[model samples]
Target: MAVPDPRGGPAPAARAGRPRIAIVGPTHPYKGGIAQHTTELAHRLARRGHDVWIESWSAQYPARLYPGQQRVDAPEMEPFPATGYPLSWWRPDGWVRLGRRLRRRADAVVVVVVTPIQAPAYLGILAGLGRAGRRAAGPAVLALCHNVLPHERRRLDEPLIRAVLRRAGAVLVHTDAEATRAAALTAAPVRVAAMAPHLWTAPSRRVHAADAPAAPDRAGEPAGQATGEATSALGGPRRRLLFFGLVRPYKGLDVLLRALAAGPPDVALTVAGEFWGGQEATQALVAELGLADRVELRPGYVDAADVPALFAAADALVLPYRAGTASQNVDLAHLHGLPVVATSVGTLPAAVSDGVDGLLVPPGDPAALAAALRRLYEPGVLTALAAKVRPPDTAGGWERYLDTLLEAIEGQRRVDHR
Candidate 1:
């Protein structure tokens, strides 16, 4: 059955006469920063009464090809009904059909672009929309870029990303560093939209209870647990360091483990989130270093709903990435009022004000990471850093983002008029 357009033509009652936009991307149940941003973007735009429609994935990833456990977790809330349009990653036919459906349904399209893996699919969709008549009120594509390209230092990824990015009406990046990298991709107008703050929007002091451990106490140690650091008069958990998110080779987990080996033995580290390729190697390294117990590894895809608990349980968010642009994890840390400790690679410094919000060390330097970790574990360091963190201003703050997107769309509209 062909999915009928949910909104039958532009209704007279749409507030301010703004166009109803359709958001297309991976949504809820998917465990990752990209999925979180897509869901939140839809929620924020929808609250604006602009008639937002989320066209989520019919099948996000094939099982054999997927590195993680699943494409998405079991849906917590009601699932968005299928538009009766299903697309295969390998086949452009389905994307062509879906693109036509989207052009008819929405005045604008916000496509959240992740990896180059999905480039062909997105490009096919764009081609279909382009053919739907340039002057027609077809959906305008706004590419919300999480990363300009893959982080594994692939030269081809740049061109691959640029090709699809150029096809879009507008591109949205998360940080200044990313803007620079993306600028090299295409002259297409790019908007620097900060990633949404926090793991989940509503901030709460109450410890998020999940399968993960609860928030730690003033002793710099986890609550409801013993054997970690104990508070001395002033409430503080034992110094806990976290390297959250997926474990991939480029993420520099091995460097972090080596740093842990070099750092104070008492300073415990938590390596949460699932492993993609280097699990055995990382685990073997941990045992080789005799720091097996010092490092806690929770290797599995963490559901978005469960992120709060994992974040709250730690004292700081650490990113030892070898290469990459700004991380959504840093934004989430700031939103949760947690400080960060990261290497000087990509736009980490852009998100963190060293000695202010968190600390920054040289990328791939274990000694520097060790020193940084020691400083963070020192008394009052975590609390002081946490105090410096202010929740990111995301709500109603997409002016730059909206302006750039409008310019591209309107420019294209004019070209079509000619």
Candidate 2:
């Protein structure tokens, strides 16, 4: 028998025993940190004895809107068994249909919200779920907000975010700062869940001094002057620093280049990952700063198989982001047992315990950033920081994260029942 509600549609049937959970986000075929995080969470949840299903996008973005080369990466070598549904982003009808199916099948649905661009699709899906809930109790909705507000903002961002958040039963954020921001936007209960390292395996190869590349020659400069402070620290080879991830305006790559130009001439840098805003300006900046020889730029998405070698070659990872709520790159650095030199913004202060696992400097200050880079070569500084670095599992493991998520779900359920 079905229960009746104010809207007058047949109510969804209530279930007993273990909960059926569905994750609505990008996974596997999709590339980037968010996709990897979503896929990893689904596997961890399934391992913890829950019936899990993942609802992934058939078409995430139109090519015109996406600046990257490809939408999906090559499938991961070790794949997780997920019942992935290829739902189109532009189809409201498909959103509603999937929502209705999820309402009937699952006890809870976790939605991963990263950008405001997808709010329209989510709006339609939630609307369908709301209608189903009014007739009969529908699955509880949990919004796992990777970013409550995007790094870049536009006029419609606020209204769109608020509308989508209102439809969620609970909101999960990575930091306390984000929790406060989410609370200000909606009345939805917000939970703070720490982000664990995304890398599941350690690097197989060890980078040796012979593997280091020689620093490029600076134009119109004598060989002795080109060697700079870095040569004095190490007589053998230049130490490598990695500036990784998607190149965006907010990421402060220009700041890093300026710092590199001013810092010791003995250090070399590798800029990996695809460029979002085009690489012309960055390349121009590198040449203008006379860092052409010192900086090696690899423009494109890095495959999963090659990540370990990249990390193994660097002495430290540098993130000079101008603004951010949280960073998964910090976690990745720690997971790889490498020290990080990141700006003190968003959750970075909490992520890198200044002088412990990494060093923190004020954002957008080239001199400060350069000083921090120099400090990495100081006696025992890098060794001390690397010694404190802990694997993500040991730091706050996946089990703990899953437990926090379940608690949020149960808490929301109790409030709804009341």
Candidate 3:
């Protein structure tokens, strides 16, 4: 049945119960941290008894713009159960149609704003929702900003972000840092919500061919001991440290390679996820740094079914991002009981508790990062850190996250009424 458009006239009588919500972003058939996050949020909201649905994109990005293979390889681990509509990002006309469809059934709309490129389509959708019309009592629009501005900023990014923020009744950012950035962009009431871990289910552990010898004891050696001092312990199958997710320059893969070259020789770093650019530079750096035997580059989109094994096989996850607002990789690693070695950039410090769940190093500092990696091989440090790690769901969890989202939506509704 076609639901009535709530904004066609004066504000209708309030519903007695939960508000219906429509989450706008990418979902199944699309693969990435954002898509996975949207899917997880939708399911979580539905479980909490709110009527919810996800309006996913039919075309997220153009072929030329997206470097990796856009499809998921495994299907056995699909988590979301809510129905999703595939809306096109390139079609402004389609935005109006989808907006109208959502306005009829939903009391609120949560639009996932990741980049400036999505501003045009979202602007059209918001315009159709009465942002420019007399029907100002339309469904509350909340811009769930993943990144207020892209790491590599473009000329029109500010104006485009301003255009969208102006239309949103409220802006929701994942971290305090991101909240600050979003507040600088517009006067919209910005709210900060913690990014819960992305794992909806426990991932399976990947089994290797044979058990490798334990790492050598680095009991009293100074932090900057030469590679030879750590060679024997690292010689047998090296301890695997993972650098997961899309291989982008801003993510600092080069920095990680340099760190690996300088760190203990027995540790092998796995470079998982699809490479966003040419791998020649990274490969060349590895060879130049004499780390050819210490790094494994797995360049392709990792499927959900394969994620468990990947995290299970690794001793720790390393994120050497030069710049980032937040990390789903940290959440994923913590979910599987693996410690993270992340740089103190953006939201990473907030996501990872130094010496508690993982260790934080200065961004772009290969020496600091290498020292952290070496510390991971120290007796009992990895196990001790992993023991203290808390998954997002356990520490305040998704219920709290959903409450914050709903509260923001309710706040927007109250503002519209006023």
Candidate 4:
């Protein structure tokens, strides 16, 4: 027998002993890592035997809040089967209605908290669920924080984030540092679960063997398969050291640029992805550094189909984050068989394995980053690091993350009842 979808679409058949889950966040038509993460989470949960649905947003943010392009011409991942866009920034009534609907439909709710701007809408949802709704009577709420707070803080960030987290029965953070931050704001249980691999490609996308002759990038550029500036035994720099993803202030692309100028002269860089702000400043920096000839800037949303080539054409992925919680970038690079050179902040040290898989430098320190870049170009260093690069254990990581999430839901519900 087919269970009726609350929104009038066909729902999965109700199964014995399986929970019905509602994941509230961005999805396809929405771009970037968070959107992909949310969609993949729903798919993984359903694959693991739960009945899942994505309660997505028709209008995620007001133009004033997120000025950049939000939707994409093409999707980067497999879209979830059951999704509804009943929530919108302009509709407070929809928020409350969706909340009450979720109470009737889902066994639990996972609200993907990407920013504090989402707090007001989330509060409205919880309000419709009766503010302090009892878990026995309604679905338990878990605030799955991609960032407990944005790396760049705002004036109302604390109070807004506090409102949502405290109201939530449990909070899930991606790192211990984020848990510490979340604990300061909420009395609810805060659990640390590392992000799973969503951007992971098929096994075929793995880097060709080190000894394999220089492979041509899908775009037809030779992979060079080389390391840095100087012509080594293998030849000269084929891939520019890469700085991919959103260019936000906290991400430290400026620091990376300064490092690039000071590091090996022959080493070039390709900076890709949309800039949250500061495109002019970045352009000016490139001009100021005299790196015009050495840098290639492609500032826009990169499609999912183009990701492998970005990784393919890079000697290493450079993540010079001044601060962070966790990111799928390091794992994404490893899956492509590309090593990383990143800052030692947040969960990066744990993920990058300094001197093993990737090099770690101090956050916000241009000199340190420059030195790491220079070191990366040293003869044979890049190859040695690349050899250690391994694909993230996608299944194991998701299973562990799911286990933590489910346990948090149960544990928080028990606490709420008490």
TM-score each candidate.
0.81, 0.85, 0.85, 0.89
TM-score of 3: 0.85
- Whole-model Cα lDDT of every candidate shown, in order: 0.66, 0.74, 0.74, 0.79
Ten consecutive residues with minimal summed lDDT in candidate 4? 207-216
lDDT of 4 at 202: 27
Better of 1 and 2 by TM-score: 2
Off by over 4 Å in 2: 1-17, 131-137, 200-236
**Candidate 4 residue-wise lDDT, 100-211, digit = tens:** 8887776778999988988889988887665654333477789999988878888999999998988888899888888999999988889988887777332234421111
lDDT sort, best first: 4, 2, 3, 1
Better of 2 and 4 by TM-score: 4
> Per-residue alpha-carbon lDDT of model 3 for 1-418, expressed as tens digits?
1222322333233446677777888776677778777877876676666666677776877788786787664432354555555466667788887777666667899999967888888887787677644346489999998888888888999999988887788999888888888888777799988876555332243221011112233333332232233233445455678889898889999998888888877787778888888688888888899887777777887766666667666777899999998877886776666778999998888788999879999999999998998888887787777767765553355667777888999998988878
Give the winner by TM-score: 3 or 4.
4
RMSD of 2: 8.0
Per-residue lDDT of model 1, residues 1-418, tens digit only: 1223443443233345466666768765555666655655555455445566666666777777576765554543233343223555656687777677777666677777878878778877777777323333465677788887777746667677877877776678877788887888876677776554424422233222111122223334332133233221113334456788888888898888888888866666777788887788888998999976667787887655666656666677889998877676886676655788888887787788898879999888888998988887666766677767876555434444455555655565565456
